[model samples]
Target: MIKILICFSVIFSSGIGLNLYATHHQPVNESNALDLAANSKSAILIERDTGEVLFNKNAQEVLPPASMTKIMTLLLVMEELENGKLQLSEKVRISEKAASMGGSQIFLEPGEEMTVNDLLKGVAVASGNDASVALAERIAGSEEAFVEMMNQRAKQLHLKNTLFQNPTGLPAENHYSTAEDMALLAKELLKYDEITKYTSIYEDYLRKGQENEFWLVNTNKLVKFYEGVDGLKTGFTNEAKYCLTATAEKDGMRVIAVVMGADSTKNRNSDVSAMLDYAYSKYTTKSLFDKNQQVTSFNWLKADQQKVNVITNDSISILHKKAEDLTGIETDVKIDQDISLPIKKGTAIGKLEVKKDGKVISETDLVIEEDMDKAGTFQLMGRILRSFLNK
Candidate 1:
């Protein structure tokens, strides 16, 4: 979820390239054992917090993402939940269109009703095309509208090569994304954290105690077979071949890896596994701030509130090669100086940059803790006048 935005109306930089002393760092090797170049059409591995690229092969090549398209679907669903526009307990009626979806489904009957929670389970654990359409219809009033939302979001994230023809990664004429873009989507989706509760489940019964109960299993098998590997998504198509976006957390550092257009499932898994191995072996992270931790504050006579707290939008970290020396590290915080009021929550108020040897190694946005509206004209004058008199 790198180096990507999870909030509405947010923009992200492509992230730092760690040229810190310009040592000619390269994460890819065709002759090396990583095998990402040989096993997959496109692939990328990145640190979740720092958005640092560890290794990449054909990362920007646009290819069908298959079922991994649901990563954006899940991201939008989580945003609705976080914004209180949707609730997990809410119920949705299955539409005929939703029920008629082909390829990898939970088999929802027409007119059947399911909770948003269960539909998420179906989509996350089963790659349910029907469930994806169900949630899409509920959120945006139609699958077409939801697909529009998905494309708009992709643009907002500054993803250049991604476009959505549908919510499920079912084969479609114009539906495609790059490995780097898919990794960013997974990074954005992972900010919800609660998503793993569904994505990590290897097996579960969807309609328990019912005669037509459906058994749902995760398409991403690494969650069950690999230690610390929790989620993401897997896909296969006659055209797209096999794909997987996988994440694992070990020793407090989480990493995401994406593989697209592999010839077979075993190769797909092998490629991602090798990518993960490369990340864990070569790099480690230094934590700076936990998510939502206060970094600074500001007060102004023109604001409705007397003061506003600035905090990190997400946890901040610095990535380093495991054997690299730790020295010459410094952090710089710069808050916006130009005065403006009525800023909404999640608005970037400032920047935090970490430099090593006077070069920026990492950067993250610092945001306001809550909304701030303008102060009354008279109130602002009074504060300014009082300050002048006191001085």
Candidate 2:
């Protein structure tokens, strides 16, 4: 028989052993104009560095996504690649169903063979519908099953306003996503930097050996037209009109803009570009607090130490206007009056709430930074005597 032993340690900050506990809260403000006079039915601009919404217009309304559906498909495929379930060098034979896919294709022939790397390039840079379908078939044995996986992933990501009817975001009656949902999906996709290696390519060649070399150009023009513009996806259809999900990184600031139902391709591109500019120009990242920094000191009762230092668990940063003075900001460290013994390390014992001119700006968790061993009987008695004597 094996006995399981559970040993808990109480952590303190700056060599002090005391218990602390509290709640943390913060208030955020969003004030940016990226949706200026755009006829787009829905739009959103978000700061990629922090999941903050900079501007939004009818963002939650689910509308036809068109080719934008490929974003989620690419995300799942990248996840599979990272998990070792799929490899870029692996070859997938095109099936009849994949070859039959119409609208924006790399012209894959049935029984034609291509490496997963080329297919991913086709889908990411060229927005090739045929490549998307072929990859889907290879992953799930059928397009329908792959679509189901997309829906399941959507639920897992909490994209409530999204539904996928196809692996490639072609025009489908039931397939739709809101501007807000698309932004969320884009944020999640950015976690995997591997996708950018292909999305940022402006032009490339495919099928070099087969007598008919194919030239591929990225559908998202910003990759070549704008500076610091990397990726996302572009979409268009009679019903969905012109849509674009553009991502840009500059001066350490990253932003994602989603526009849907634009009247023309030019307006869609302009709207997304303007949104990115507004976010990068108007806001900047500021480090408010750091982890394991001493926030305050607390008095202990019947303990070996009379006082303990409180600290934070993680560093916190906030996006604010450049004109704002962060040094003048006031921080209030709140903790429980009393904490029990046998406390564990890394416990959230309190919070450090920073405010600017009475308005709370950011809050971070104050945790125990070091472990505190349990006091023995004699130690406890000595602490009690000390407490009484100090009184």
Tens-place lDDT digits, model 2, residues 1-391: 1121222222222110111111211112333333352768888877663456777777889899999999988998898897689999999999998999899989999999999999999999989999999999888889999999999999987899999999888877789999988987997788777788999999999987668689999999999998989998999989999988989888666778899999998888888888777777776765545546676665444344546666766554455555554444456676644466656666776666655444554456677655555556787788778779999
Q: lDDT tens string, model 1, 138-190?
A: 99999999999999999988888999999998999999999989988888898
Model 2 TM-score? Answer: 0.71
lDDT of 1 at 46: 82
Clashes of each: 2, 4
Q: Any runs in candidate 2 off by more than 4 Å, and if so which? A: 1-37, 286-317, 327-391
Q: Candidate 2 — what's its lDDT?
A: 0.76
Task: Please provide TM-scores, in order, for all candidate models, with all chains considered together.
Answer: 0.90, 0.71
Q: How much is 52 displaced in model 2, in angstroms?
A: 0.4
Top TM-score: which candidate number? 1
